[model samples]
Target chain A: MEKKYEFLEHTADAKFRAYGKNLQEAFANAAIAMTNIMFDTEKIKPLLNRAVDIKGDDLKSLLVNFLSEFVYLLDAEGFILGRIASLTINKTSQGYRLAAIAKGDKYSDKYETMGDVKAVTYAEMEIREEDKGKCWVQVVVDI
Target chain B: MPKRTELLKELFEEVPSGVGKGGITKLTKEELLDLLEKGSEWSLENGYGTKADLEATEESGRMKQADSRQVSERALARGKPQLGTLGAGNHFLEIQRIDEIYDEEAAGVLGLEKGKITVMIHCGSRGLGHQIASDYIEKMEKKYGYSHLPDRELVNAPLDSELGQQYFKAMCAGMNYAFANRQMIVHWVRESFRKVMGTSEGMSQVYDVCHNIAKIENHKVDGEPKKLCVHRKGATRAFGPGHEEMPEKYRKIGQPVLIPGSMGTASYVLLGTRKAEELSFSSSAHGAGRALSRAAAIRQFRGEQVARELMAQGIEVKAASWKGIAEEAVPSYKDIDEVINTTVKSGIGKAVARLKPIGVVKG
Candidate 1:
């Protein structure tokens, strides 16, 4: 499915708007948007492979944890997951669990740091379905 | 919509606010840093509060891995004298009453009952934090020419850059200073209350959280778990139940989310939910988003009239500048209730209790 992503400016921060035909596509696009904020997307290559699992009670929280974890991977391990191989989300009695594999090359050049996100906040967050058979999520990282 | 003039008038009179305003206590630089890193723990150690106070604080009043040496001497100097002082705008020490309980179980656990008086302290690293941000921004802008960046406001340096690390360390120290400052103020507030009521009945900290700051953490994104730095400006973390950070007592309920409203309105206490993990990096809004600019507020309201209105509502206020008062009128902010509602509706947090102001002290 085709997807579109846009960057929105916040007070000393940046937010991304991702639209896709399904949740997975939207999330993938969102990942692209976030990494693009730090470096040129075209320069990044799909080299290394990594997998992640996240749990949350709702889509919004899960999205935040997902993005945060991605950023963490880049900052701590210097690994960037440039491609989404497969993604699956399941709803459990406790919450939602997400499992997926990402592929990307390791960051070599000292990546510029944008802002240190202290923690994800609950303020002004929204996730909704668009008129097209697509889903949208608007998230504001604390940084 | 409420008239901005009337709103400004009411806010000026009820909420204590201003810049460079001193609070009831003073402290030295060393003393302030101790508070900064130690947070409420310093207060407890100094006999200003009890151990129970730490339980109510985020991170239990201590942030590990803070590199105080990274703090600049100038930043330290700026923070030294400001310790124990509430240096103005939006910073306040309010004495309030638990006028309502939204979730009885949560309120009971929080040790709050209707009619119980509570004190809320709102301030940050003050000059120290401001100086750190300023110094880093200038250095980064000069080197990176971030002015040409897509968003000039998002100016920053590489994470491993000397400037970046220094800012992080200094910022942590500043946070520590804030923790200590609020702890000291809590001590004074207790003393003042004891004096006013002629009783030694001590008060405890409900919770202490920083809304503006950054940190490093581990999370999973797109199924890949990684470590990243999270920065929250005008935001707060709402870690859910069973998280390692949650105090044992609150693990079942989740982390306490303190949401303060405009002076005339009600503040809320909420608990984090697991759902927040997906939504916002387990984050939430800090407060009602500003609805009016300070200049607009000042132009719309008269300070004196605002004070009178608050007094009429039985709320007592002490502020440093009438202009400051006029600028923060309650109407100038988004309805806090709505903001709280959004949080709950989004399933990030659950309402616990509501607090109404009885007395306020602004800087």
Candidate 2:
């Protein structure tokens, strides 16, 4: 198993650096980092799934929208995420389109929800392939 | 006030069940749309609280600028369900005891006294507000391309631009949602008190203030009054005595600024000072302010241990998650007393009353 993401220190909110072999993996890992912040991911079961489709004018915006959909599901539907089944990203003429199958379950009494995330802020949002064959994305969420 | 144990039990039992769900109170699309438009006015008209409560709220519980049409469909979808919820992370509803009075006259005006019990509700517009911000951030970044900006988070549109005005209207709707959300919680609290104590006496609101907001107000700049868009993030509006917006009863003393502290810590009630209007734009610190990240706090303390410590101090703790408790340990936050001292020393606000929590319910 590969390391997905790592949490960082922020004065007023939660921050994380997610890693992947490529952009799709990086976005999926970012979702994991965010959900893991709320509770122990091991306790969650991938019993249910949802489709995520987001459009952005650029790669950065694409990542923000992708993560934003998870935040929305959690708040609106009480859906807590477990794992990412698959993700596909394509560059379109206008911008970008990301389609993903997110696996998770409805938040239930059995799980201890650590925190509620407000938004995936653009504060420190950035993507880089600092090392060969690896990509890194940084994001700070307003809790 | 009822006995501490009884009060705490009532609060613990009465808080709406489940963390994220909107509780038993269901709202149709039309009703939620109305709430986004009217804010606390909807709550008042729906009989959630009294008009006096609105008078005590910032903007009188309604932002006339709020245009529900400006809110995006995605934002509305996220907000429609979470309308009356106690959001997770740091948000809470606490029953506290007024332990000290710094300004006797000011405290009297705000209905504060030593040993008086009070309820403090803290929450926001929930997913609706979050989605609106997410939607606009991408919009602004796409339109302006903020690569030159120091941080992408600083991406913004000119306040007078069409996109800027649209975001403003949507943000105002979000603010209104928060105002109405808090108002609904207040109603549930009164009912909770009545259920446990057989009466809702002493549950009257002292004041309700919004910390995160942008306001259009008149302020003197260079000896001339100018209308400015004042944005207070992580800060509260502390309008001093005689401000035209303050309630008639508070105009003589000053607007009430409720500075809540982390669980198991002391909270303060401060009154706006004349100095604030001159120096800090009539704004004061919102909380003790998070000094430690949640991850660091979790590593340093156990949630159960923190809960035990608070219980030993006679503060009852009820939360949906223990990890949530560990993440909000007292050591994770700056000292309330010290923060309040800074506010007083800077003359941004004057201390009026101090509160110690007896009961706390966190999401």
lDDT of each: 0.67, 0.85
Over B1-363, each residue of candidate 1 has an lDDT whose tens digit, in order, gives 113233323333333221222233456667655666666677678777667767777777777656677666656655654556554556666667788888888788778898887777887766567656655655675577653666544678878888777777777767777777676666666655554455537465667777678878766688788887888878898888888876767877788888888777778888888889778888888777778755466568876777778777877666655655665577878899899989999998888888887666655
List TM-scores for all candidates, in order.
0.66, 0.96
- Which candidate's DockQ is highest? 2
Number of clashing pairs, model 2? 0
| Candidate 2 local lDDT, B1-363, one digit each (tens) | 446567666665555534545455678888888999999999999989888788778788888999999888888888877777777788988888899888999888788889888889888888888788878887897799887988878888989999999999999999999999889888888887787778887666788766687888888888788899899999989999999888788999988888988898989999898889889888898999988988899889998999999999988888877888888889999998899988999999989999999888888
TM-score, first chain, each model: 0.84, 0.95
lDDT of 1 by residue, A1-143 (tens): 35477756453345668877778777777777766544455666877888989876577657766775675565335566566787887899987998989887876533322122323333455677777686877665433
TM-score of chain B of each: 0.88, 0.96
Docking class of 1: incorrect
